[model samples]
Target: MQLSVTLIIIIVTTLVSISGFSSQKIIDDLIFYPPAVTQQRQWWRFFTCGLIHADFGHLILNMYALYIFGVEVERAFVSIFGKYGNLVYLLMYVSALIVCLLPTYRKHKNNYYYRSLGASGAVSAVVFCFILLFPLRKLGLVFFPVMIPGFIFGTLYLIVSTILERRSSDRINHSAHIWGAIYGIVFLIVAANFFSTYPVLQSFVEDVKGWLASF
Candidate 1:
């Protein structure tokens, strides 16, 4: 079976994440330490850090979300972009890793104790990209069991993430999530405009408008 780009990424991330669980050196080397980037100029940490996770639960959630949204996003990109479909998808995922970390790097460039590891930023980019593609699509929480429009869900997610980021009470980088999601939307809109001539933002608005008319 030919593995898709999404599956390939998941396989590599899972293997590396599992290894990170057993080896502190692996984590230390691959994990995002802003000081490493600022002082040592280890720029690759911006991207490599996303290949490992803090734990199995974190790994699973990020990869699961990636698979759920990535498959569809890949297909959509193909439909809109023709031969460059997979290429654009890959670019978005990889660039999202770096783009999503820029703010974090700025904030923690000298915070020697600051370290982050996970694919959350890239995965958030994928999820938000999918949300833009299908604004009317219904999303349901794992616990709440109530289905809501993708745009609405995305809105709530950004709001909650912003609030949590302000609190700064957790190890998770909520700021990365916020920036990742914003980058996702912007990336898709810009890519569509320049590469495919598709009015993605307009399409999203039309989809939402149609959904609103149904009520």
Candidate 2:
């Protein structure tokens, strides 16, 4: 099999997450702990936290989402940005790890108890980027019976994520999902302006409008 960057990311993330399951040290060192970043200046945690996950289910869900969305987004980036596509793709993933958690870090930097791990934020970034490029594409949850157009899914996702972030006390970082998705769309627009002649934003709007008109 030709090893694309998306495949390599999935493989590396899976291996690291599995290794972390056997070694608490791996989890402790890599998991996002705001206190560590604030007190000890372990800024690398912003990036490394994405390399480990909390459990098998967390790892699988994240990597599975990444695998599905990342390949298409990567391919689109390559077609748009040409030789620099891979670099831009890597930047989107890594930056999403840090940018998506900025709010959490600010709020909990002194809360020694706050901790999180997983690549869900980065995966969200990839998924949103794909949606931006293909707004009319159908997307559905694995267990959900209904499939919806990508733009509608994106809107619903943002609403649900915002609600979950505010009202839910679950350990999941819904904030990251919200911010990561926004970052993905904004990053694509910015990069597209600089790197390619493709009317990224216009195309997205036209695609969504065309889809709406069809209905």
Candidate 3:
């Protein structure tokens, strides 16, 4: 957990510094949306945009959430998948990004001017993984300070994202966050069931279950 958290912090800080050093205008182009049909085209921006942030506050808030949620998820992954845990996490992160971007890319193929940024997609992966691993656990919102079941929080987040996506001027990339959560929940459920039936995987899972039971 400590190692994973440290690596994430280092990666986020490095990306933030790179964004600051890049031309100010370049930051706008790299933000999760392609440029207008009239502007110069850059296909790699889809992946690079996620590495930049709108501000220090934005980066810190996202990183904080990632740190809080990602550590537990990594532990769960390692308990279930052993040495392959990091690979699974990486795949989930990349898959969520691609899945979230595909629809936007397809819809704005001509205009290519829509834009987004931040670590919301990766954060969503961690959040939803927590929801999956500990669905019955309680969580409290920072703003509301109201305690709620993890499953309820996860469901409400998805609903809110869907509603927010319809609004025209909303700056938040709620859709990506929602889809990323879905990807994490589905991936873990499927992987857990598939691995539970295998000899080695089942042994690891049983050991994890025993460890959890002891707690």
lDDT of 1 by residue, 103-144 (tens): 999999999999988989999999999999998889978888
The number of the candidate with the highest lDDT is 1
Q: Which consecutive 10 residues in model 3 have the weakest lDDT in total? A: 196-205
Off by over 4 Å in 2: none
Evaluate residue 45 in candidate 1 and report its C-alpha lDDT on the 0 to 100 scale.
Answer: 100
Instruction: Report the C-alpha lDDT of model 2 over 148-185, residue by residue, as the tens digit.
Output: 99999999999989998999679898988888999999
Please provide TM-scores, in order, for all candidate models, with all chains considered together: 0.98, 0.97, 0.78
Cα TM-score of candidate 1: 0.98
What ranges in model 3 sit over 4 Å off? 25-29, 35-43, 195-215
Evaluate all candidate structures by whole-model CA lDDT and list the values in order.
Answer: 0.93, 0.91, 0.69
- Model with the higher lDDT, candidate 2 or 3: 2
Model 2's number of clashes is: 0
The better-scoring model by lDDT among 1 and 3 is 1
Tens-place lDDT digits, model 3, residues 137-171 = 77877887988867778888888788888884577
